[model samples]
Target: MTTLRILAAGSLRGVWPDLMAAFHHQTGLTTDTQFGPAGLLRQRIEQGERCDLFASANLHHPATLLQRGLATDTGKFTANSLSLTARRDVVTKNDTWLSLLQRDDLRLATSTPLSDPSGDYTWQLFGKIEQAYPGWGERLKQRARQLVGGIDSLAVPTGELAAQWLIDQKHADLFIGYASYAPRLIHHSHLQVFLIPAPFNIQAEYAWAMLTHSAVPLATFLSSAAAKTILRQHGFT
Candidate 1:
């Protein structure tokens, strides 16, 4: 059996193994997957790196691949939203999620925009904040530290959650990242997880692209009930 080549978003790292195992059991086809920032992965594909399937954290990346003729088709498979992870000590008894974000004393960390969908979503959230409160959004954007998910960002230590690790290391007082990570991040005693509320939150739509005819089956499988169940188990919608 030929091994399928897959390029996936780093957000899927914690769940990919379970998903792949299920795929293999159902189809007997194995996969070799590479996980990274979706935008960077898309750049690799555009720069001549071949993959049978490309799973991105956002629909736009795979849709771009389809538009460029690099992919045969693209469709959404799962969804996620943003969350605010903060150092436990920073959150006060009276603080709401919005209050924490507006404080000048806190250091905000986000992924690198344009190189990661998470960063893109964070910026979108900022835009919403700006629309509601004049000048606050711009202040948040100006102060945010783009600490990871760039082409040259520091490598997160093996098996560590980026939000937790960054906070534990004193790199950030608060982090804005995918809510899918909240289940794990919440388990950390020193970290607090806050789901961004509606009207202010951005929904991240994960999309998959078929690079070749051979990848069609896998792509179809990914949209099945079994796959969605696995995704939900991992905190995706």
Candidate 2:
């Protein structure tokens, strides 16, 4: 039996099980997945983690890997968009960010802009909206800083971690996470998902590639038509 080791972004959590089972049962290769932030995963590889496959929420991390001679022959696939998510119970008199940002009692959470693409994209999205709507940028920025005043706050990493915190732990009243994570987001009774307006949200593209340390042929198999079908079935695109 071929054993494949995978390092992937946390956003893939909800769909990973299905993808793994199908890949293994059909190709007879068992996959061991280690999911986390794309940046964190990249750091692991840089630290010499022996992983066969690396799929990231943003292509940047993979690009970094290739630039650093850690990965090779990358392939781009799938896409995602940001959503303004919040707890359902939060009595948002405004509910939407357009209105919520101006409120005083709300707390918002997002991944780290420097380390996580989702966080970076969200910041840009918010900036875009603020540009379109006068007076939004000033208040939004202030509100963000106010919400996360603690020094040891969770510097969110991947899109999935954001959703996980909202649902699994109830860490934040509002957060911006991945589009595909919507189904899982619904599990949070107080969580409600909303899309950021066009020009405000970034168009996410998820990519996959092989690690230089790979000992298994999983990367080659992933590009096969059969594998593509399974990924597409799981909402990869």
Find the candidate with the highest TM-score and give its number.
1
- Model 2 worst lDDT window (10 residues): 144-153
Off by over 4 Å in 1: none
Please, what is the TM-score per model?
A: 0.98, 0.79
Q: Which stretches of candidate 2 lie over 4 Å from their true place?
A: 91-94, 138-142, 145-161, 167-171, 213-217, 220-236
Put down candidate 1 lDDT per residue, 1-237, tens digits, no spaces.
Answer: 789999999999998999999999999999999999999999999999999999999999999999999999998899999999989998999887899999999999999999999999999999999999999999999999999999889789868889998998899999999999999998889889998889999989999999988898889989999999999999998
* Residue-level lDDT tens digits of model 2 in 139-172: 6655553112123445454443455564346565
Q: What lDDT is obtained when candidate 2 is compared to the true structure?
A: 0.68
TM-score of decoy 2: 0.79
